[model samples]
Target: MAHIVGGIFTSHVPAIGGAIARGLQEDPYWKPFFDGFHPIHRWLAAARPDVAVLFYNDHGLNFFLDTMPTFAVGAAAEYHNADEGWGLPVMKPFPGAEALSWHIIEHLVASEFDITTCQKMAVDHALTVPLALSWPGADNRPVRIVPIALNTVQHPLPSPSRCLALGRAVHDALASWPGAERIVIFGTGGLSHQLDGERAGFINKDYDRFCLDHLGPEPEALVAHSAVDIVELAGSQGIEILNWIAARGALGPDVREVSRNYHIPISNTAAATMLLETPATLSKAA
Candidate 1:
């Protein structure tokens, strides 16, 4: 059976992509955020995940307000990244784990998640940025991917609790898969920051810290707040934390935080990165 290595959560702010494109890692403004990934790089080098299951929100690149599924899973052979006009360069195509993708799609449907299936999908910064951050190189990344997109661009987003359940269903699917591949789950986007409205540029450091502290050990505590409450407290876009919540659910009940870094005002977003794996995995690695 396939083995789930662990989960990695991070903020997928577009500006980080531009910083990489321009080689601005050492720049004072971007240095702190870029530096945070060094430990993640070391961990990936050791863990070497074969496939990445990304839980991310599309930003009008693949889905629009007129029509967007609450959840969509990619089953493509290859996933392409297009320029989203955010001053971020287009990224090389990411290879897809087609068999794994289909398996997850089937399992999700069987589990009554009512998710949309995409034979072809164009990924945006939400998916690409995390990949680039984790595997920084000019060539295509070594690992294949299965992109799972949740609707956060429009109203009626999936509740935090529902996303958590979706993650649990995915965990079950992976558990039943027969492949020997090692998998890593990625939950990308937000600590907190709003881009528009009178409360534009809003960020709640206290809330962000609260989430970072509890997401690994007490993920259920986060779902206690309704989706609306998340928006009001974390900001509208901060609802992206739902991605993190879902990723946490897939880790089973034994999670250990390996590393975490938090920095403020990364494009007005409270950027964060966390690495979590089973305590057994950590002990074995030790």
Candidate 2:
């Protein structure tokens, strides 16, 4: 049986992927952080999991506020990349692993996760763009995907504890599977930056670090934090740390950081990536 490798966190800021591609690392503002994620490239290479259960929230593209589900898993054969104002660069399209997906969905519900599954739906740029940027090429090849989309666009989104519970259920579901040997779970979203209103430019380095601290090996702290508290600190609509908490909760305690990177530019968002490994060594911390 394969081990449930664990989770990763990253920002899906569109423009930044292009910036990094254009050698933004040379900019004094971004270099140290780019250096921070370089280790991820290395970690990814070594782990080489058979599948990646990716979690990403759409920016009102795929799941609109009209009829939103708390969480949806893609059981589609192929996902089209739609433009979100800016035309997304076409990369390889990922064909989800239906077998694994069905198993996960079945077990998640049995565990009371209640995830929505889509047989066919066009995957928006929110997921593909960041995934492509993170791992160029090799779609559904080295790492088969089971795409999970969260409904963070709508207000009164799943409560922090609810999201965390779902994550714990996800871990249980994955562990129950007897076939898959190596799996990588990813939770993609924000860390303290707002994109609208007068508070748009806010960036909280302290909060970001605090989140990473509590996420790994101790998510109870975040569970104790109120939604209002997170919104106030991270911004009104920036309370998506719940997504990260979900991913962390699934991984449970006894985790170690493989890599961490943080960067903030003119855009009203902070980009960060954290890689957690299960049964990780004590020295892996940054």
Give the winner by lDDT: 1
TM-score of 2: 0.89
Model 2, position 282: C-alpha lDDT score: 30
On residues 67-161, what C-alpha lDDT tens digit does candidate 2 reach at each position? 89988888766666666765445555676667878887898878777778888766665566446545654243566677888777676777788
Candidate 2 weakest ten by summed lDDT = 277-286
lDDT of 2 at 157: 72
TM-score of each: 0.98, 0.89
> Which digits, one per residue and each the tens of the lDDT, describe model 1 over residues 39-130?
98998888888999999999998899899999999999999989899988877889999999999999999999999999999999998999
Q: lDDT (CA) for every model shown?
A: 0.91, 0.72
